[model samples]
Target: MHDLPARLPGAQRNLLLKHLPEPRMLCTMRSVKLLPGTAFFTGRRSFAAGVSKEAEPLKKLVYISQSNDVFTNLALEDWLYKQGDFKNSRALLLWRNSPCVVVGRHQNPWVEANADFCAEKRIPIARRNSGGGTVYHDLGNLNCTFFTSRDEYDRKANLEMIRTAVWDTYGLDLVVNKRDDIEWRGQKVSGTAAKLGRDVAYHHCTVLVHSDRSMLQKALRTGGVKGGYESKATISVPAKTACLREAEPSARVSDVMNAIGRVFLQNPIEDKHGNTVPSEAGGYQLLNPSDYWFPGLGSTRRDLASWDWVYGKTPNFSFSRTYSLPKAHNAGNNPQEHGIASVTVTLHVTNGMVTETEIKENDSFSQTGGSDLMHISALKGQRFTEHLLDAAVQRTVSAAMNAYPRGSSGNHRAFSPGPRLTQRSLIMESERNHDPMDREYVNSILTCA
Candidate 1:
């Protein structure tokens, strides 16, 4: 066994104690130990923690998940929103994901994020069931979800919980901005978003407790498409973000969680419609995201984790971009004798597939002997992406190369190297030499936003 450190810093000490059950109220609070592959739909286990001999009926409950998987947490949120018989009950879910980026339900991942960077880092991008700007999550982040009936849904009221909790616990004042975001000083520390179901509405916010700010910025970086990109997809509102850990060195995730829990348990809730409900000092339930505990939750989890629901749900969009191709020259005859040309592409994407494509060659290149334009029929019905488009062009170029060899006076050359091969060859070379920023632009346009 290892011995404890002689002394932990003040901040570290606070963090260690924050995770433990408050000694004064251990009898009221329940600590659930979750094991892997455990299946059982056991009803919420409620003990008489802090219950007076005449304790009033409980109107609200706090369900904290032991899991950190974003997909699992999202599935649990969905289940809670749809759970039948959710009458006067209120719930606060304290959760955090390992590491992931979640986009809004209607936001286009291609337009709102750097897919290549996220993929390289092995961080999955999720499209939550709510409509909001994209946000990044990791262990240092905390997710607090407040559930209320659809009739009594109030966003401002929820933000207040975060505001009051932080101020009361750490003496940190949080400014609730007009956008409903929690701000400290001038930087956004927490962002709020909500989803409304038929019967329930839940407002969930991301608390930047100790997130890697650099990684968060990198994951949500959406660059490129310099020429011009237009889409109906939701645009993200960039904010100067701050973390609780940055604000307070000793700040632990547990501290923030407990602060919110204490406020949720002790304070009364008032809706926008002038209805106030008081909650006693109630026990918070720690639950594991298990299908056994919540029937049909397994299927919900699968669907949320599926690609079709996430990427497939994006609305149709048009992608238009111009590609610069390399100069074509007959190396045998004045290899330097070449001019500039371009390929302008406008793709109409429907259901993530290119339904119609318009490929236009610029004035730099001209067809030979009334030669028809490169047949872009192959491009139709293809996945509207940059990589796929380049592949398609390469196929056409290969075919042209095979038909025509150099010294044929560019006759056999696919569209000949000059005006004939201008569009295809130029695009291929430029893409090969594309700068990282340019590649990001290309990736943005190629995607089916």
Candidate 2:
């Protein structure tokens, strides 16, 4: 945390110091100074002369983000947490994104999101600087971030402010659960997460107003097979989610945002003398996120949108897929040619890059050459992405086809290369085949997650 100047510029100092209550909060506008490693207070002494003086009354602000981009909004939060002075002020930031899946700082995007679905729909994913469960964000979902000094950081207080706002404005009775999420009739309508800093802290949460629940469910799931990905990343705790509009049809994102902002500013701020003081009401400021307003903010947004921070930061994990090779339909009743063969490919990934590859074939009748390993070795330093993984598998299968010419039973059994082995391929084939176990297999992966 950068040390505040001994005194602010004349105009700014007057603006901040004017809010201090007289007598108790004593200090002339020009005499105020902020020493390093000390709370913002007037340079005054108590009756004993050596005792600490009371600090100024807190000033509160409410800011509404003008941009809907997830990375830009996240950058605003980072800027406020790191640069904003919260010693005498508390701030509330309300924002909404176009359509994105936000994962926690310690989360794995591959495990928390459906890569194929996100890619097909073109919904970007972002990793926040807070540790919590994953969440889906859209224009209909309202995101709230409360900023305060580290000493005044309180997650419950922030949650209660939201709960009060919802109930008071919409007559919706919401309960704050043990996990800090606000529930409507036992279904979660809001989820909470927070980031703490040395001098500042912010608690952010998501409130579902009228988001697409179907898309939320599909986008939050991964395409990986069950028991395939093994990671130590923090997995999200699944919950039965509900939107505020579900109970109250008229509930709107704007109205809810206004209500929350109103409640936040209406609350009183206390001075160090235990006096309840009216909070400095800085009505909602429409924040246009840019480098002009917040220096180095563009860099922060870039980091949030970069691959190194998104997928490359994922914890080390391993994924294994086992699939059977379909035999030729023309091979009639010949047990030797009809042998059941399955191939299992296990890959160990570190820092979102393939570090190890293992391939094994369970063939009862014949054995193929080690040509597949040659192609698999190329994946050692490649990214553990669906596109790269698919390409590698296809190259391996293509090599196998060239090694043994099809329709030639002279040298060895004709090798039949099946569909490219991938998470999406397994899902599509498994579902199209209508195997009950296939359905169960896909659903079993997130049990541990």
Candidate 3:
């Protein structure tokens, strides 16, 4: 962890000092200073200090009002990451952004979104550095971000807190489904995703109680296969989404917000952490973090909004099909003589060597020949020198020849070669051959037969 500055510029540090009820909380914020230009509240302690010689550290809570913009959320997350707040404090941020489609970091947004539709409707698209499917958000949706120390964070526990809060507020039994979705009456109402940092983590989720289901359906259309090529991509099965208002006609966004606030207020007391404010001191005031906006920080409107980052990150591979003539197909008199024995192999290659392979063949030659070509194609990108290929082919051909007598008709049987080399390796060899700036191309010779 980077050491925090001893003193920060301006009176922002003083704000925290003034708000803190207990003197000990100052020690925690004293080491670091807020950035020179930003405004932050200081000096309000979250927990009461004990008089005993050994006192437990007071817990700090920062409440931030929600923004209806995607860029604002990204900016807050980025600022928290830089300030190291993710390591020290727990943050509860509330925001209901305009309609948008948020995609996981490793996901292909093109597969998860209807870009043209979203563009036409003016709905923003965001990509987060988390592992999960895409989710839809709108003003009617509530987004809660929980930032906590990695060591103390429990995803399930945090989710349960939200569940308990909703249940207590609305008397609805929202069940957590197998896919980590919060559902009511078989309709999905919320979805969550988490991003883990080195010493901290951020878990955020969307509550869909009042979002426009029709808009979501229209904005999340699936595009057909790409490049006249068909390969598996991450897929999301659309489901019926409902808002809390549908089930409880009396429910409002304000009611939900109050329930959430109650959950946070009751948290400290329930956890055996005494409240710093006395009963006479009254209910804790929920203060909104100062508003600071920067257009450059809006990734949803810029980089994430681009197709290059969403689709270009996908790993590239090639699938090729080859065919041969079966003995029956080769015979002039046979009716099947014109039929072709075809094989289609799909190869996945990374760093040159094939990592995965699949093969499919026609039914006519099934009995005569069928091998795990899928497994063989896996060797397509494996580094093999000319010497190695020559040796292996010779050894295999010699073995097959020795098995049959030279005078036998079977001895004339032709030997079929293995799968072709992967494109990456061919490109590397070609580059090495023609590039004037090329350095030595290291060589490896395989003696394996």
Query: Which of candidates 1 and 3 reaches a greater TM-score?
Result: 1
TM-scores of all predicted structures: 0.74, 0.75, 0.54
Query: Clashes in each model (backbone N, CA, C under 3 Å)?
Result: 13, 0, 15
lDDT of 1 by residue, 119-140 (tens): 8999988889999889999999
C-alpha positional error of residue 160 in candidate 1 after TM-score superposition, expressed in Å: 1.0
Q: Rate the local accuracy (lDDT) of all candidates.
A: 0.66, 0.71, 0.51
Instruction: Please report, as a residue range, the 10-residue window in candidate 1 with the lowest summed lDDT.
Output: 33-42
lDDT (Cα, tens digit) per residue for candidate 2, span 55-161: 33455667778889999999888877877778667889899999999999988888899877989999999999999988999999999999988887888878999
Which runs in model 2 stand beyond 4 Å of their true positions? Answer: 1-55, 222-227, 269-278, 325-341, 361-368, 408-449
Prediction 1 global C-alpha lDDT:
0.66
The lDDT ranking, best first, is 2, 1, 3
lDDT of 3 by residue, 177-287 (tens): 877778889988888878878787877777876888889888886444332223344445567778888888777776776676557545642122433421111222232
